[model samples]
Target: MLHLMIAIPAFARMYNVSCKMCHVAFPKLNGFGQAFADNGYVFAGKQGEIYRNLGDDRARTFKELPLAVRFTHYVAASYDGGKAMTDFQSPWSVKFLLGGAPNERINFYAYVIFEKGLPPFFEDAWIDLHGFFGLPFSLTLGQFQISDLMFMRETRLTRSDFYIYKVGPYKITYHRGALLGTPIGDFGVVNGNGLSALNGKYYDDNPSKWFFGHLPLPADFGLFGLWGEDYDTLGNYVRLYRLGLDWRGVFESFYPFFQILVGFDNDTSNLFYGGFFGVDYAPGGDGVVSLLFNYVDAPANSPYRNERLATLALRYSHYVLTNLKVFAEGEGWLFKRSLALTLGVDFAF
Candidate 1:
């Protein structure tokens, strides 16, 4: 059987509370948990305070800057009608989570990832402003995964075949020489030496240049060009700019969310747009069901054209020990024609 774990025991230590208070399962946030995040990870009453100094006249010192570590391991097997691949991955990944309130109105959250065959980097680093000019709006800044705004990827227990966070469409490029032959007028012929020349430029299947590098613009100019464009060695296109918005709210017993994003491809100057709308229905204890629809539209010249994905997931959990949980989840990706079933245990001390 496949196994998945979404536990975050660090937050439990920071609040000195039971894990069930915020999560129906390990990573799935309950209604109160959602409010805790929206409120800068602070509780509503005096019990949620983390700062030492209270008055405006005093310089406040943090009572605690909580840091927690999580280790995840799993074994997976997949069959696609041909050969089946089975592998055991233990201690597969690790994460360092840091989150807390610095002051009354500002909260910070950051996490670092340590995975096999990849350099360690900060996966998510963002600051949330509780209120802007006394309005209900908040501003988030830093390098963070934008998809978390609506879909809440972390809360999902099943491994995804297609990475949902990669919402942008990829640009497609064709070699100019391939177009020369046939009805398009031949500029050259395939020589016995496996080389051809076009317009006084020698073209080889392996050693020919198809694109040129454009100097990157300074960040201050508000336009950043690709650092290098070596299509053969590097990628063909670059992600230029992205703007997005996400909103989550509760109406009666349903938690609804909507998010949209627009991105530009630096190589083609084409636009890619995508969004998702979802609702979570949690009747009472230990079980929650959700339905989500996700869609992405690439530019006409993009390789994928348009890709869409939808998912339905269910999570159920219970505590056998004080901070230990037995949880299981089932999720299906409608478009991919795949289903993921997970059974895992979460231990938090």
Candidate 2:
């Protein structure tokens, strides 16, 4: 399993507030945090005071650069074949998060990730344009995780589960053009011009591209759409177009949410659809219990054609110091029939 971490302390510094103000735990955003994000990372309270030169007619400047670092490590033991293998290893995933509003209307978020045995890469780079064209919508541009529009997989503490957001249809390659001098009726066996009649040009394939927008409606409801192209393990290319609707609200201390996404794979003419309904019960402070159900359906020719996932997780966290946190969580996946117990710590400075 890939160990991914997401914790941003820059928001705390930007808002001059405790991490609890926006997060139920280390990375899960609370109601206030969601609002802050919706506003493009501009704090509703004491905004101008957090930064310098708010009245400047020139480029916006920060009193101090908003940057934060996070490190996470865990130890685990798994059971297999009536035996247990215990290992003490460091996931050793580190993240450098940087972003904040240059001004009230514009906000940006970016992350540089370094992981064990992997070269560093820029992940989740995006700029948020709040209230686009004086409408109740926001425009986000850059490479981002489309799953975030529905369920926030980053916020979940499960290490042994696969959710619908992580599953999709298989890729299908398109024959753009036949190889030169190849028979028009023959769609097989020719390799020249770097374009094979059997297999189209695989070289110089670009990475996936994405564009999405979000609109906030009344009653804590939101709608979004995403369009992009992705490649599968077989090197087949697929185009993804998705539309989603979500509703979230807090009642007392419980946060209830529902999300549905309808996606289409244009290349293969397949349907990719899913829904996630869950509730986070945050009694208070830094402890949260989550129950979520996820269901996805894809075309028969696609991988993960009829996969369904459900997860139940319990988490507790405590601050050892102002910038250090200790947490332990246990989660189980119903379909995968797996359980994971994790004891980890997070520190930010």
TM-score for every candidate vs. truth? Answer: 0.57, 0.70
Can you write out model 1's per-residue Cα lDDT over 270-311, one digit (the tens) per residue? 666666666666565555555566666676776435554566
The digit string of per-residue lDDT tens for model 2 on 1-349 reads: 0001133788677667888777765567766777666556767757877667657567678887889888877776655445666666475678888888887767777778888758787766666565546655444544355445445565653343325555544211111111111111101111111212232445224544444444556797777665666665577776677677888888987877887877776744566676767776767754556666666666677545656456666656666764576777676656666776778777776
Candidate 1: 10-residue stretch with minimal lDDT: 177-186
Off by over 4 Å in 1: 1-11, 47-59, 129-139, 161-164, 168-301, 305-343, 346-349
Error of 2 at 253 (Å): 1.4
lDDT of 2: 0.59
Error of 2 at 152 (Å): 2.9
Which residue pairs clash in candidate 1?
none
RMSD of candidate 2 to the truth, in angstroms, is 10.4
For model 2, give the 10-residue run with minimal summed lDDT.
Answer: 178-187
lDDT (CA) per prediction: 0.49, 0.59
lDDT of 1: 0.49
